[model samples]
Each structure stands twice: as structure tokens, then as C-alpha cells.
Target: MIDNEMSIEELEQDFWGEPSFSSYVVTTCHKARQKPIKDLSYEEIRCLIGQKIGLRFVLSVAIDILQANPLIDVIYYEGDLLLAVLRLDLDDWKYNQDELKTFISILQENRSKIENFEEVSNELVNKYLQIRL
Candidate 1:
């Protein structure tokens, strides 16, 4: 059985081997995919979620992390994680209602903090709201 408690690398994932993508973000997702959930940093989580690699496993963790820090950042700046989530496929969120709502709440609660740093974030956040989810 795949162990939630172990990293993909530790479990010796058989479906696919390690990926050596040319892009930094792509590489981050592969490296982060091998690390334990608890061991993953906010930036790594953001990278994985942004790539939509394993939402079934990673989405809830992202929610919990966002609850602690709605403005969860990456190398670029704050709210980058939030933006990554916003960019997630609408279908990816269809069955994830509770998690999606919690994320919306995080946006509502931290709107000012996000807008203060990323000027375009407000527009993106507004667009996210219009989605049927």
C-alpha cells in the first residue's frame, strides 16, 4: 500500500521514475514529490499544487498550510501559493467543496495582506469567486 506517512521516494514509487525537467518549477515539483508531507516547505507545497500533480493527496495539506498562513509564499512573493491554487483546474476542485470553501475563507480573511504585495492578485481572487466550484 502507498503510505501517507512516507515520501514517494521512500515508498519506492513504481508507476514512474524521477523526472528531470528543464524548468525550475517543474524540477521543484519532482523533488517535492519525493519528500514527506510534513517535511515539505510552503514553497514546495505551492510548487506541487501549482503543477496539479497529486491533488488527491496534496490539496488538503495545502488547505491546512493556508489556514496557518493565507499569504503562503514562494521565491517570488507572498500569496503565490494562493495564486497557484486559484490556477488549479476547476474540475480538480469539483469534489473538494469543504477544502475549497476553507481556501475561499483564507482569501477573504487575508485579502488586504495579499493585495498589499501582489497588485494583480485582487483581480485573480475576484475571478476565482465567480467560478461555480
Candidate 2:
């Protein structure tokens, strides 16, 4: 669990090991104007799972972004795999027939990064599988 004393920046640095997407603005829904959950360390957020104290920062960011564009039909994430279904229809031409294209774009752009992430997740999954077996 994240120590309640630490600031959001501190948690982001601890977990992601990089500068958070936004360091200055508070992103959470809290009335006190606290930073969003993205700043929380993975372990910290995981600890608060039952309480639902905050949104999953990474998931929220991605979903919000996708929702804004209006191209995605649906986005289902199974662990690290972001399975997206594009809504392609002639009536809604502006946002149609591009789901596959957008998916490909996301895959191409983030392939290397996601590949590494999946490798780690796969190892963990395999470990669990072996235990079950």
C-alpha cells in the first residue's frame, strides 16, 4: 500500500519511473482536489482495489482518450492486451470504417512497448498456470 503521506509525484516516480503525464494538475474526482489515481503506484492502487478509492490512472487515460475520438466501438482490456473494436458503418461515415485502421495504428505505434509489457505479464501468467497444473 502507498503511504498516505507521499505526494502523487512521488508515487508516479516510484511506480512508472518516469515523469507523469501531468504533474501539476489534480486529476482525481476527490472534493479536496487531490491528484488523479494515475500518480498512485501500481502496488498502491492495487491495495485500494476493494475500496475503489480512485480510478486506474492508465486505464482511465486510455479510455478517456479513446472516448473523445469517437472512433472506437469498444475497448476491452485483458491485462495488457487492449482489445478494441472499431465501429465501421456507412451512415456514420465520419467515424466509420476506420476501426481496423486505428487499431493497426495503435498496434504499430505501441508494439515495442506493449510487447515488453506483455512479456512480463506472460511470465506471471505462466507461473500461475504451472501452479494450477
Measured by TM-score, how close is model 1 to the native structure? Answer: 0.76
User: Poorest 10 consecutive residues of model 2 by lDDT?
Assistant: 83-92
Write the residue-wise lDDT of candidate 1 on 1-133 in tens digits.
Answer: 2356776455545334566567888778777777776688778877778777666567788888788977656667776777788788667876577788887787778777777765346777876666554
In the range 9-126, model 2's lDDT, one tens digit per residue, is 4444533233345432222222111444445443333223222333223333333344343222221233212321211122322322243344445544544554465322433323
Show model 1 residue runs off by greater than 4 Å.
Answer: 1-3, 8-14, 131-133
Model 2 misplaced stretches (Cα beyond 4 Å): 1-81, 84-96, 119-133
lDDT scores in order: 0.72, 0.34
Which residue pairs collide in model 1, if any?
none
- Candidate 2 local Cα displacement, residue 75, angstroms: 12
Q: How much does candidate 2 score in TM-score?
A: 0.23
**Candidate 1 global lDDT:** 0.72
